[model samples]
Target: MITLQDLRKVYATRSGEVVALDGISLEIPQGQIHGIVGQSGAGKSTLIRCLTALERPTTGSVVVDGAEVSVLSETQLRRARRRIGMVFQHVNLFEARTAAANIAYPLAVAGVPRAERATRVAELLDLVGLGGRGDAYPAQLSGGQKQRVGIARALATEPAVLLCDEPTSALDSATTRQILRLIRDVRDRLGITVVIITHETSVVREVCDAATLLADGRIVESGPLADVVTRPGSKLSQALVPVPDVGVADQRTLVQVSAGGAQAQIAHALYAIATEPDAHVVAGAIETLGGVRVGRWHLDVPDGDRAAVLGRLRAAGLAVEEDVA
Candidate 1:
């Protein structure tokens, strides 16, 4: 539903030109929730701006739902933007407007009839789990409710793609989970493509079907969650399923082991490792991501037994990295 080809964006400042995006190429399929994660200067915001035609790429194309948005004329771009909904981290709602009116604003701008706007706003309110709260103003709503209103407003135009920029960063843990679940529910119901831009890896782990990690204005890692999380020693894998740091008493070598597959397959690997008397798990994490059970562990093993234990793990179909601190 979205495609970016060699996307690059450069900005001119007092010092010199700074490249916010460098050679970014990506594809996100319809109805998929894709996460873009990076630190502040990693070009995530620039990429989103480019995708929305808010910032033109220096020498690349931005395509969404089959339209090359980058080259569209202003008149055309305005129409094109109606098909792309944007949800911001801050719920930038008009303080005086009620939730229903806030959601109706987009439809109003689109020249929707007042009666039709009311019907659509009602449906959206119900869709986002805020049916009776349409009469409430932003000041009267909780943070999560205000965000729900933002989401409903974004969907008011029935966009083909939803661009969520830090959608859950402001919410508490429980509220974040609720919002993430709502995003998934939106995708499942409307089949709309979603691109979530976030700095939090936990957000990616919870909601993204696929993810891209950015660093230094370039893609460091990009793939389906299942594929990336399972690959041993992958940077994205480590970030998403990190093994906690735990100090062991003895001076034994630490080996990192990981595996991804069916529940039984991962369970089998765990059992095999359990049978090794000399190897003790120091830290580990197991999670079901993208329909696969993925496990990563740090094991403390005697130097003399490291080779044998690693060999056995490899033979038993687990990826192992030796002598990791």
Candidate 2:
């Protein structure tokens, strides 16, 4: 339930005017995890700040939960911000405060009662898988634990939308996975809209339903994760997931054979195609995505037998294609 239309944010420096965001228009639907991915200085941070009203956009409109955030006064913007929660990369929790107290801080500021705040904090801790760690201080917790506490604190007020700014950047791979799982769980259970800004494609692949790729202060690509990852074209896509290598050999055809079972089928197919003395397999790899084995095999076959090999693969009920240059 967030929309940005022709949102532009420019900054004045000693050199000249810098366009941090150049006409970025985006829509984040409710109850879905949306990601903004790009390299450093691609306006990812600027976009998030503009959305949160921490930095006002130079032009265009920002509508969040039906309210025009761009036009709201300072006092009104503060009120609007309460409906949006943010989790920073550094897990910005008070060092002296215990986990429960850190979470209670938001409710405390919101004028929530002590008993209700306690209950809410407890529920949040449980939701973030830190139920019994409420008594621990931030110093005693691991990176992942601190982030969970940050998440609990962010959700203390039960905000409708959550903005994560490189939430897993500082954590190790294991910790990153834990934090991503926690974020996914929160989104699924609360139906809260999540907008994650990260440069890591692995993070987006694991958690995001859809993503937008930003470059040179503009959106270069935006689509569903699977479609964007599998289809080649976008520069962002190429940087994110690498395509399988298909070798080039003159006077030979590249035949792709797909089988349902394990590597044995691949070996059998190679054997069947071995009748041609010139047949050779250049590259192969098997990867499981969405619980299916999507294997890619590149074969170098003589020009004469290329059609016949393709015919045999098709007769076996497998998807076959010839690479034509």
Could you say which candidate leads in lDDT?
1
The number of clashing residue pairs in each candidate reads: 0, 0
Q: Which ranges in model 1 have alpha carbons more than 4 Å from their true place?
A: 248-251
lDDT of each: 0.93, 0.81
Give the winner by TM-score: 1
Residue range 1-325, candidate 2, lDDT tens digits = 9999999999999999999999989998998898899999999999999989999999999998888998899989877888899999998999999999999998998889999998899899999998899999999999999999999898888888999999999999999999999999999999999999999988887788888999989999987665554442345445554346776767777765544344565466555545545557677655433222334456677788777767765665455556623
Model 2 poorest 10 in a row by lDDT: 287-296
Error of 2 at 219 (Å): 0.4
